[model samples]
Target: MATSSGAPAARTFFGHPWGLATLFFTEMWERFSFYGLRAILVLFLIAPPADSGLGMAEGTAKALLGVYMAMVYFVALPGGWIADRVLGARRAVLAGGVVIMLGHLSMAIPGGAGFVYLGLLLIIVGTGLLKPNISTMVGKLYQGQPDARRDSAFSIFYMGINIGSLAPFVVGYLGEEINWHLGFGAAAVGMALGLVQYLLGARHLAGVGDRPGDPLTPAERGRVLRIAGTVAAVAAAVLLIFAALGRLTVDGVTVALTVLAIVVPAAYFAFMFRSPEVSAEERVRLRAYVWLFLAAALFWMIFDQAAGPLNIFAQRSVDLNVFGWQMPASWTQNINPILIICFAAVFAWLWVRLGDRVSTPQKFAFALVMCGLSFVVMSVASNAAAGGARVSLLWLIAVYLLQTLGELSLSPVGLSVTTRLAPRAYASQMMGVWFLATAAGDAVGGQVARLQEPWGDVRYFLLLGACTMAGGVVMFLFTRSLRRLMGEERRAVPSAV
Candidate 1:
């Protein structure tokens, strides 16, 4: 057991520190808001103006959603740095929660497209601040505990995320079935509840996240501020110039972000590999990680399409009839989280029981294959749709189930490997580098989904599925060498949800 501030360890929540409960619930609500809004974002965009939506084209809507998602992850790099060197995790989380609340509220107000854009900007900045820091604080709760305990705490915290992800069923139903603003308002309410609990449970976290991991001295702080200010000014000026030239369209912004999302990770890898700080052994591990990163990106590119094209598929092509009622299309988005909650424990146990029978690289290969199969399911469903028949909702549910399994295989393993292989001096930066993989996946996935309009559903799904399967095969062939690069010893598997 780990003690906080030199006091005896107290087991207040399920034999874990009380702070875990606070952070857990806070994160749950934050995720509830995030996923809730995401579940309905594209649907809201494509809905007719008569339905209180912006009446945007489906392609444009998907592109915008992609850009927003990419930015949310991309900003985490600076957000983590700010928490570690400036405001500390606690204050950063608080400030982030406030901004997130305002963002949701702004969206809840039925004004114009400007409100939507403003809300997204605030939520992106707020998520950048909160997402990485809250997880850091969870680790702090078990600071001096054994690795087992810390791993257990993380498992509990991950459940909070899955539980929160379920909120889209409720919030999404409201937004898609009733009114868009109302759903946004409900998300705002969820965050408000989180903030209230966070305040009430402040006592449990007395010694945690109170200060930065590495605070800056006065001179260093001044220099950083100056640099940040200069960069902001230059960025603002460039944006203004683009807007004045009538060139700052949504398509333009999406293209720019897509390029940035791809380029940043490549640049990070180049910098890390070339840096003298990385040992030869660490460099070998980094090489292995790069391969894993590419596989992870491919998996996410397919999996994350759930929120864009899949949502559209559910609404337009799938039969939504239940026993006696037609369900809302947003309800389809709930399948993945629901399945994750149901099967995560079973997968965790299977991994432990199987032990060295499955290596990390092997798991990545499995995930890629599973992801391709999931899309294959969708491809078949699209064939049915092409015949002018609305496929059973069960088809979509099957796709989600397969994709959820793929997610379980890859996501947790990737997190553990990144932590294990990261160079000590660049640990945080390495974590940011890992997130860049997701940024690339989302940006590219969105663009790929856009192809559906031109390529048609059958060809789009088949092409993506075939390409993904090929990638998996290539990864499988390379797994032996990658595992060698990871070193010969079988390491203990870290806990992942």
Candidate 2:
């Protein structure tokens, strides 16, 4: 096992065994913690209050689901900032794991809206710190060979996500079937297990995520503290204002997220345009990245539905009848991870075989199409259920299988592309920006899902299908230009688009 030092050895995993294994489990547990909570979150929201759940109205629940999910992704911006400028990836992951443990533990508490929201806030912050930074550790694992084990590593890594996701759905079924708190408590336990493994494995992961700053100068230290304080204050003010204005309510959350969808990107753009640090080429790339953001957001609008609208679709419309038995609706959440574990290898092979023939922009175009097509499956299912009969559960499963394949092509690959194309200094922030794009997608999905209540399910699914398809079309139109904008820049550049 070749250990990671100041620079990684230009060697294969066969040449550096421990490095790969270390990255694998660290990422796995993180995903386990993350996806487990996601499995039952919406169901928890929509579960009847008498059942010891949130008992939110369906449409409102969908919106809040979107808001909460969006806010979760929104944290990546600051998480990336703290990692790059302060804590470094390793410490960030450690801190994030602790926070996640606390968050999950909080959820284990019974009763009260305040506790529930506080737990969620903590989880969001923890995920922000964990998600992007953990991936950074994997990158650090193989310093010189960016492409060597990249796809395989992500494939293995995302499998962890699926495993985590699947465990939760199973736990949710048992817990909700037995006791609600049981499921929440089970999720907390998963985080604890992950944290223990991480701590035990710390020595093997030496030198991976330390911050670049040696002893910080007084001015630099002061600047960082001030900026962090300001950002925190701004975040607090926004939350309070939303609370005061009723934006945190089920009715207001969707609107609040929509506003944030506009605000965060606009703010980032303003920063980009004003920053004297960026060169003309970097500015142009940022514009390209913006377009990429819009395109990817459309993709997520459809893809993220797996948790919110899609889960509901399964609950309300999909039949689980098999051998005279019925399955819980939340169980459908397991499909993506299952399929991801199965198909990740196949997609990785395809990407390897295709190599640079299909450009990143082109791959993104395909992702948008697949997302639209998944929605088309849901539309068909929705139509099938129009006569008040449940569509076959197979429909939901098939759609998720397809969506997972699409995600394999786009989501993880998109992260790789961002790290490759973005300037070095902004790598973490660019990753955050990528997540911000997803935040928009999630918010859009929520708003679009709300249309189901008024427009009917068929129209709702159809709308998502149409928008995603249009995004795919637009991406195709700009494929050449986007590739040009990405340039031939290496991943080591200091700032990202």
Candidate 3:
């Protein structure tokens, strides 16, 4: 509705802009498709061929899962660039949703590994285009709004994510207990519904995410395409040569990607440190961010295994039999989201009530300690299951509860800290860097999970858990220094609440 001055009046959905509602549902469905597929990805890989599965080695399957998870984030940087430069965030989101639906459909076909790989590739590409830009759109919705309102809007948006993420228990059950292809198809339908909702709500999204923030000139666009084509051709040629030499195996590809994910981010940080664009104070903050980044990576490396080694552990070691019924192992992935929904508000209230009493580094220290303890508990469970006895379902539930605490401590705080510490010139890119921490961590975790094949699960849980607690202790030592670097005024601004 137009105001008296021929300008559109601000419309609100539950007190925020109406546009937020559109973006919120879009993101919800996107996450629904993503978490749904992830819930069953490993299960389908290791299931017996006679059970219509791939019959892949457990190590290979896990490594692939890690690489796939890493690639989703790693690819998002370029994806966001493309959305900002060419398609605009809105169109990119629509295109991405369509592509994701297609990806799920591809996997649903009753072919072999080839179609599954094709599906995964499509999902990655679609997600790359869609995931980051939608959040960008959310930010756009509150262009001139105060920080507190923006934060509240995001809280509402975040609830959509957790709500969507709960699809795994529902979709995952069908995939595990009924038919795997059916589950994939259901994910596709979820995306389709998201697209439908997005289209219907497009009228509400006018003046946001509708144009490139920094569009390239036509000549620049051509140059970019040529460069991209050349890079792709050369990379493909190299892969073909390796394929002919029989060295282009899955492990080889995963190793190369892992190296790429870790090394590129490290090199970027080094360049940023030396750049004249960064002031001395900014550089000091960047140094602090470096520590935080490592802490975040360490946190995610353990946390993200919910779909890989942890899932396998639940399948092999947890008694899925409930009272009189047998529960699907994939349903285990739903616990964290359930906990998040139940307690996200309580955690927020605690942070608000505590105010700045807790520093960012201190919160991260808490996360590391709790993450370590979760695995320590898992280590005990692993030992108990050593002789092929299934432990009670409460064991995995306990681990997820601890990790959820760790996640609430770190995830939102990590974002707030990164935004606070980023240099002005590279403010947006630093958000991508925050995701890079996850990619690097997941890539490394993939490689680490491979050790389970040689070292076994009990030792794996015990050793990593011990090391993580040590990491927490080290972070606590540096807490005062990091708080100083973030600036005294920032310290007084209260915690991320």
Candidate 2 on 1-497: residue-level lDDT in tens?
A: 34567675544444454556555666666666666677677888888878878788888877777777888888888787678777888888888888887887787787667777788888888988987788778767666766757655665666666666677555657555766667767777777777777777666765778663344568989987898799999989988998897666657756866788869877987787668877787777777777777778888878887888888777777877779977777778788878877887788788767766677777888888888888888888888888778888789877887788678878877777777656545655677778888888888778778787898877878777877878888888888788778773242223323
lDDT of 3 by residue, 1-497 (tens): 89999998888888887888988998999899999999999999999988889998988898899989998999888989998899999999999999999999999998999999999999989999999999999988878879888898999999999989988877888898888999999999999999999999899886798898999999999999999999999999989997998879888888888999999899989999999999999998899899999999999898988899889888888999888888888889999999999989989998878878878888999999999889899989999998899999899989999999999999998988888899998998888899999999899998888998788787888888889989999999988888888784454764364
Using all chains and alpha carbons, the TM-scores for the candidates as numbered come to: 0.95, 0.87, 0.95
Clashes of each: 0, 9, 0
Where does the lowest 10-residue lDDT sum fall in candidate 3? 488-497
Residue pairs with backbone overlap in model 3: none
Model 1: pairs clashing at backbone N, Cα or C within 3 Å: none
lDDT of each: 0.89, 0.75, 0.90
Model 1: how large is the Cα RMSD against the reference?
Answer: 3.6
Query: At residue 341, what lDDT does model 2 achieve?
Result: 78
Quote model 3's TM-score: 0.95
- Model 2 alpha-carbon drift over 4 Å, by segment: 1-16, 19-23, 144-155, 210-216, 227-250, 484-497
Relative to the unseen true structure, what is the C-alpha lDDT of residue 61 in candidate 3, on a scale of 0 to 100?
Answer: 91
Per-residue alpha-carbon lDDT of candidate 1 for residues 125-212, written as tens digits (9 for 90 to 100): 9999999999999988887779999989999999999999988778998898889999999999999999999988978996788999
Q: Where's the lowest-lDDT run of ten residues in candidate 1?
A: 488-497
